[model samples]
Target: MKVEFFFDVGSPASYLAWTQLPKICAAKGAELVFRPMLLGAIFQATGNASPAAVPVKGRHSGIDLGRFAKRYGVPLVMNPHFPVNTLQLMRAVTGVQMHQPERFEHLLKTLFDALWIDALNLNEPALIGRTLIRAGFSIDEILALANSPDVKAQLRSTTDEALERGVFGAPTCFVGDQMFFGQDRLDFVEEALA
Candidate 1:
């Protein structure tokens, strides 16, 4: 079996899912395909806003996410810069995944750790450059690829495909045609893999 993980590095929930899905797929002897999509585009296309758009729901969601983080024994510090614009970040991700598949997982880990675990404000270009440099990535190469027309088009196509797959949010997992919407629904994903 294979799990198509449609994700954006900007979403904390997607970071949580990223921490768990590898283990889940490993135990199930399943392949985990990383489908990097633009979450902002997904929201705009679907007319679905982040839970943070609603103050009460955002607070509740934060608490719930904390519970999950504790349950998973993983660190998740909500970025003070919540809702960071991730257009270039996602494009860089797509570019890396396309040009250097081997470094793809490393890049994901570095970015996720920066945003969720370290609580870095990745929305700032200088900070992002420093973070990537610290992670041993060449910022110049990343920038060149991220700004390339091919990378931009590929990210857009992936986001469009995600929309067609009924994906309205990040951390969406597909076990065959079974669409699981949140990191919290990973149990269902495991069952589907079984």
Candidate 2:
């Protein structure tokens, strides 16, 4: 089965899904494709809102995410800088994908871990630069790609394509015509793959 995962760095649920889905796919002998999409754009196009927008759901999600983190044995924390505008971050993802495909995995892992595991405040460019540097990434190169017009267009086009795919949120996984939303749905995803 072919698995496509649509993600946004700013979403904690996306990070959780990232941690778990790869292992699931590997065990099932399925190929997992990581797709970086802009969650803000999806929400705008689909009239969806993050769980944070709702007080009860927001609190519950935090607890639920923690449970998943423990179950997966991966470090996770809600970023103190909640609501980080990941426009630049997502652009960097697209840029790496377009310019340096080899670095995509490392870049994705580094940024996802920074945003969710370390719970760093990635809202500031300066902090991002430092974080990238620590992750052994070229700060200049990534920033340049992130700021370029082509990269911006790539992110836009990817977001547009995601909207067309019935995706209204992050961590959406597809197995052919079957679409599963949320990290909690990995069991069903595994079933689909089988």
Summed over model 2, clashes come to: 0
lDDT of 1 by residue, 1-194 (tens): 99999999999999999999999999999999999999999999999999999999999999999999999999999888989999999999999999999999999999999999999998899999999999999999999989999999999999999999999999899999999999999999999998
Summed over model 1, clashes come to 0
User: Which ranges of candidate 2 are over 4 A from the true structure?
Assistant: none
lDDT for model 1, on a 0 to 1 scale? 0.96
**Candidates' RMSD to native:** 0.6, 1.1
TM-score of model 1 (CA atoms): 0.99
TM-score winner? 1
lDDT of 2 by residue, 1-194 (tens): 77999999999989989888878999999999878889999999899999988989998999999999999888998987898999999999999999999999899999988888788899988999999999899988998999999999988987898889899998899999899999899999999988
> What 10-residue stretch in candidate 1 is worst by lDDT?
78-87
Candidate 2 has what TM-score?
0.96
Off by over 4 Å in 1: none
Model 2 lDDT-worst window of ten: 154-163
| Candidate 2, RMSD to the unseen true structure | 1.1
